[model samples]
Target: MNDLGRIEDLPADYVEEMRKVNLVPLWPSLRGVLPPLKPKPQTRATMWAYADIKPLLLKAGELTPIEKAERRVLVLANPGHGLDKMQASPAMYLGMQLLLPGEWAPSHRHTPNAVRMIVEGEGAYTTVDGEKCPMSRGDLILTPTGLWHEHGHDGTDAVVWLDVLDLPLVYYMEASYHINGERQPIKPDRGDRAYAGGGMVPTPIFERSHKAYPMLRYPWDEARSALLRLGQDRQDLDCIQITYVNPETGNDAENILGFYALMLRPGQTLRLPARSPSCVFHVIEGGADVKIDEQSFALTEADTCCSPGYTPVTLHNRHADKPTFVFMADESPLHRKLGVYEVRN
Candidate 1:
């Protein structure tokens, strides 16, 4: 602590210079922006995001048993692409995964909070804290950091989902972990037979205090429908534009991070206002003229556009009206973590 004293600012004189430049006069000067609105910038992140999984997955699927099992895998992120394989964000990484059926990722759990949202498929089970959660389309399942969890699909089908965590957050916090989980002989608990089809509410339980995600699944159907409706109305600047919100609060899920689905309505040139946050868009169904920082790129179904945050972003609907819808996610969380988030206007 003694060695660090010199690093602290000298206060009055350091800020008093603001007057010399006339940036702020007297009354509304240094004191006005006191204490800083957010935390100090921790570090610059090594930006690594890309979208070219189909070809990779296809080639792998042909040889491996994933396809034979009627399952598929598309790695949304991984260290090979700059995303730490085990950690999500620097501060959080419940663990990243893409699983299909007739295969088991093995039983394992560690002290890293994690969760999964079923992107596609049905009848997959994720046992957490000894409580087996059967996953279905739109279902959200949690494997609290170190709680024992295993995945398996005995049904006549396969499943897929998006995984999120404090991985990046964890790595940033410098609390990353690695573990080899034990293989359990059987399913831990099958007590909640009622909540078989996902949606946590329908399931019965004994002790509810030690909790998990309040809901089993955050449905993308309603969200998708809403965007579709907005597209149908030919509203303002939407090929399809809508933001992700936390269901309980009805506010943006996380101030630093947000999501929007854009569906273009044929020949629709959706103009995206320049944003302070970098955005990544995954083409769900259609195409566009994804332009960023003045360079143009074509984005088709299953393609992706990852723009550097605060970098100018613009889009033009090239397809003649069939409608182009995409799912957008961003590092507003990262920006907030850095404490420099704001809008010029």
Candidate 2:
């Protein structure tokens, strides 16, 4: 009918005209709206075995040149959730980046926040916005959004590190801006001074033009000492957990992510009930059994595991002699800021 009796039964031509004017019919779509409550996360618990990836990384190094392979990285793709098979998750991007000795990964800057956790080798360095900082195994480096950064290895052995970014989230928002920088010599630019004064409070002059942590490098040595001391000093400790804070502002790593280093004592088990923010973890030292929801993952050094938001997980260090060191990055910053971040027993 050209003219229907009621507004809900409008003519097809009239509906088409409304749609042409950027109007959407809400009656048919509004019924599908529902609350967010759901059983376990849609993003499944996934693990990337280091052993399975090492040889392929080595082979890629032999065949591909750093100049050609802007990033000789193997992205960790989550099979359970992603628009494409190459995405780590629907919201984040995770990759294992390798740099062979004498190789230089060109400088680039992007809108998404970037994090690098050294997993293998040392003497390699990453220069962020002109300040070149040395890398060592277990060190956590932050390259905030839109910061020009590059990596190179000067050591004898190849260096590998975990590359974590909010690429998926930024890309989804259509706000991603990545630009490659010209090849240039690495500059010290007071990066060494910050590293030398590792545990001390950073001076006001050291703060760079970034919203994230001023201390770019959080050395493993200093963090290890602090964790061990915390364990020894306090008997009521549930777990030795420490957040990589922006010393100047005394806040989480940044406004979008929370980075943490936690330790589980030998033969100990820590039960993390569940929370609102998803967490991705990197095994820094020793081995542990991570039970996410009902699935179990055995992770060793350099291995990575993801426990999606609101999924209860338990970490167990069955090793009788060594403690388990785990580095984790999560949406805690966002959740906590929104007053939704929480952890049960």
Candidate 3:
């Protein structure tokens, strides 16, 4: 590659004139925008232990009340993106949100799509577009763009969940905002029950539902059973994984990000190929070791970590007698939509 001319090489007066006209030279910064080979992502290999986060979260609950805080959260921001930006990757935002007993987070809707992965506690539920979805350990609940959602807790313990959102991308497009709304009346039916079976769906011969999101909540019990069945049936497979999809359309659960559940057999080590989309991993059960580039993270239950794009990752089950399960969120849908998705061995 030839060395491009530096901005300093240009005449000082000419540079000032271009600056005054709101015009700048491209050659000096062309390589930065269009780098050679794969992209130079700012997202780094980072991890956050639940053990370290829980204490501070409980302290936050004691310090602030629900009325003043609205949603009490501690962001899991990536150092590569700068802590102030509150982003895990270029396109994803992660935060650990807490709700104490008898608390209710008011209803509101935002332009960015969001999901909640329940980390601990019980008797907490999220109401989205009217349907009330219960929160349990390992459950995933979706709050798509422009849909009203709120959280409430009935149990006597603290409820915490990992929140994943495409806020950076939506904010970058200048379409990020939220509208507060009054409390919603609970609906009669839930989407998960309507589409529980794998190969079956409501016929809707008389009338079809026009809602964009047919399913709002995915139970952890169902997902774990599916993984166990897959592992039993496919003993030869190295990686036991399942993608969360829209049962009616067989597409990714959400529009912008891909969600998956991965199971590692007892004492198994799985190597995932380098892919174009950055990924976030959260341990749901057991313990595991995650390696990305030169960084390594020992993730136990409720621990979260992220890896950049164009880098292969390795996962190893720390237990020798039992399996390990992990929840993963990635930017594949956005990458594919932009026609740049890739996987390299």
Candidate 4:
């Protein structure tokens, strides 16, 4: 092109002077580091259909024994992360874990904060330290950082759940540690626990100085009821949102992550433009349309959608009669640390 002739004709001394100052001409550097417009997220929006994955999960259980497998999980790996690792986005890790009846995943602990959103089969449970938290179809169970925990299926059928972890952040900080060994169970107090009706009797034996919440399970029944009540109170038809909080500190459910339950009424929509901290959403019930920039993905029950940090998004419930419900988790720790978390109007 004619523009290229100017560079070829430049005097040698002029180019040498530019090199000596540790500067390159603006053209190349700016294109890579500072683009003309906000770039789309490196990660792509994805969906994992439970119906398709369930049979595969059962087959995996038949092939591998629990002790040898450590954990039998099918990671919802993002295409952007390449094939080397299982990452839902640059900031999160998502997988579906399966356990056969009478099997157990031995107790262990790691630095990454983790959560379990039960996908199917119940009566299976996760024990954090000593508290027994029974798993259900829509429950959100937490296995906070460095806390010894184990999963076992005592139910008649196979148990499966979506396992989410803030591993990317932990690994990024080089704070990763793992104890892939058995842990002794602590006998939980029968009376004093977050699940024990609001009277909250003190259970000193269960207390850890740094621990935020005493409850392991945030039951779906309570969450759904609360959402319904809030929806009735609000005049807006778009969405009713609630966050799981640490009863002690009144903040997010965990120190490193944030959790939300949203209910979008039929024909309503929520437009959330680009902001800091990436988010991954799990559809709890009904169907909705999730738009990421110009691309769109339709999500149904048990499907998941990912949006990397600073990517514009809009969620719509196009169902003619029923409401759509979703559970969302995000990298809140990074957001809080950088002081850049927000929702663009």
Candidate 5:
């Protein structure tokens, strides 16, 4: 394409008049907003090591009390978006939240949809809309938009979890805000049990659940078992993966983002196709080397990495003797909703 006229080429008086009237020429910066082929994403390949973040997180716990901090968290900010933005991708926000024993994070509801991927420890439970979902390593708990959720710990150790949210997108739309509330009454129903079986869902014989988010907690044990079974049953499959979805509707668990569990067989190396949605991967078990574009990240257990959109990612299991499992969060749902989702071979 020919070079477009630069803003500097415009007449000084015309430029001055346009500036005075708050009008700006688009031809000079047109390519920036409408890049050819694919988007020029600002999100870069970034990794946050658990080993390096743990010390700082623990220190943050000592520095700030739960009473003052509400939710003691250290954001896993991507440098591409700038540290101040506190976002891992264009639409996703990631943070490591620490909850010490005998502490409680007050109940509140926010417009941004969020899910907690338990990183370590036990005896901590997140009460979402009155259902107390126990926190265990690799467990996923949802605090969807407009749902009241709070955290409490009863065990003797500190519990930590990775918080993934669509805060960046919601905040960008100027619809991000929270409403504080008193402790919610414990509900007798547990969504995990109601939707436990894979091929079965509760039949609405007597009564049906009207809530949008019927299942809030996805136990890691079940997810891990499913992946192992899938890998065992499908030896011909190159990439063993499972999507976390609503058992009833057979759709993504949440509306804004997509959650998935991926397993790499022993000595397996899988290359994901270049897609239009950026992805965040967190190691749940074993180690894997993630290569995104020109950057490679060696991620151990609990380590997390982010890859920009429209980039192919290669995941290699570092362990030859054992299988590796990873939890992935992506902007595919939002992208699809906006009619921009893609997968390039």
Candidate 6:
């Protein structure tokens, strides 16, 4: 129709003139009546905050070798809730994970991105792809995009960690796969300790890894003592949100993944910087009212929350006399790589 209409004369009916031709790239123009191309309504998917929140507790006796600590996971954006499945996007899949003493989550691997923030525990380690990193409370471990990994609690104290994966993101894409290795968990050999950290030497960068950081572990202890020390001064450096960095260069570990810890002192409320990459956080220690887009929601240890990539989010320590801590993860780095990650600020 566009061609015929554009021409001075047509030999056949307007509809008949178009029937013999195949659709082209500009199909919308076929009708000859310009259908104005409007930007898809600027919509940020639905955000599930407070109200219908239910946090489950994974109890001790119920755990098996495959799981420990009476594993409890609170589903936030799930297909069951009249919402899209969590695996559709990389920013989703926020689960609170806990493991009791003597329990182990044996070896396994998958195609989705995953990370764990030690909520509480003394000795537990997640061997990623093949590298083993010691798991201590507040530690951050990265299982970038498609690495295989497993968790084991070898310490005398119970171990708890929040497992945040791109499950919902993968679910949406339907690009998910998993493999279970033998149940045995072993420390990485000295030469193969790349997953834990040896800097760039351990990172697999074969072009494909471009825009994707594969380092698997980000420990919280590294930031813990420093936070405590800074707490003494309690000045401008308050609420240090140190992005999980490449241990060797001291540069923000430019992995496709990102993780951080927030230290909240009593009465202190941290206003999350605008353009936060759709943060996913698990309460590691203490409880507080986390304000997202100005709405306050109470969160305690083991509870998880998800914020859209570009929105206002805040963390306020409600505990009058205690310090509250949390671990946050996001795929903003990856999005930045794709040239699609942006903040409103």
Clash totals for all models, in order?
Answer: 38, 0, 0, 0, 0, 26
Measured with C-alpha atoms, the lDDT of residue 40 in candidate 1 is: 26
Residue by residue across 1-345, what tens digits does model 1's lDDT show? 112232134467765786578754443434333425432222222222224553454455456674354224444443423543543233332212346456666666655455565545676777665566777654445555556777777765545555555556555567757565665555444433433332343334534443433232334565567777776676664445776543333454443345566677778766665555546655656677777666778876545545544455667777885766776666565566688666532
Candidate 1 positional error at 149, Å: 5.2
Pull out the clashing pairs in model 4: none
Clash pairs, candidate 3, are: none
* Model 4: residues with Cα > 4 Å off, grouped in runs: 1-40, 190-210
**How do all the candidates rank in terms of lDDT, highest first?**
3, 5, 2, 4, 6, 1
* Per-residue lDDT value at 27 in model 3: 94
Q: Give the poorly placed runs of model 6, Cα more than 4 Å off.
A: 1-55, 59-74, 78-84, 87-90, 98-103, 155-158, 170-174, 183-215, 230-234, 249-254, 320-322
Q: lDDT: which is higher, 2 or 5?
A: 5
Candidate 6 lDDT over residue span 215-277, tens digit each: 456556556666666676767766665567654445445345567777888878888665635
Give the alpha carbon lDDT tens digit for every residue of 163-252 in model 3. 999999999999999999999999998999988888987786212346778899999999999999999999999989999998777889
Cα-based TM-score, every candidate = 0.58, 0.86, 0.98, 0.84, 0.98, 0.66
Question: How high a TM-score does candidate 4 get?
Answer: 0.84
lDDT of each: 0.53, 0.81, 0.95, 0.79, 0.95, 0.60
| Segments in model 2 whose C-alpha atoms lie over 4 Å from true places | 1-33, 36-40, 83-85, 184-199, 202-212, 342-345
> In the order shown, what is each candidate's alpha-carbon RMSD?
9.9, 4.8, 1.1, 4.6, 1.1, 7.7
Q: What's the distance in Å from true for residue 159, model 2?
A: 0.8
Tell me the lDDT of model 5 at 193. 92
Give the residue spans of candidate 1 off by over 4 A: 1-52, 58-98, 107-150, 154-166, 178-212, 232-234, 237-240, 251-256
lDDT of 5 by residue, 1-345 (tens): 737889999999999999999999999999889988999999999999999999999999999999999999999999999999999999999999999999999999999999999999989999999999999999999999999999999999999999999999999999999999999899898999998998877786213347778889999999999999999999999989999887767789999999999999988999999999999999999999999998999999999999999999999999999999999999999999999899998
Count of backbone collisions in candidate 3? 0
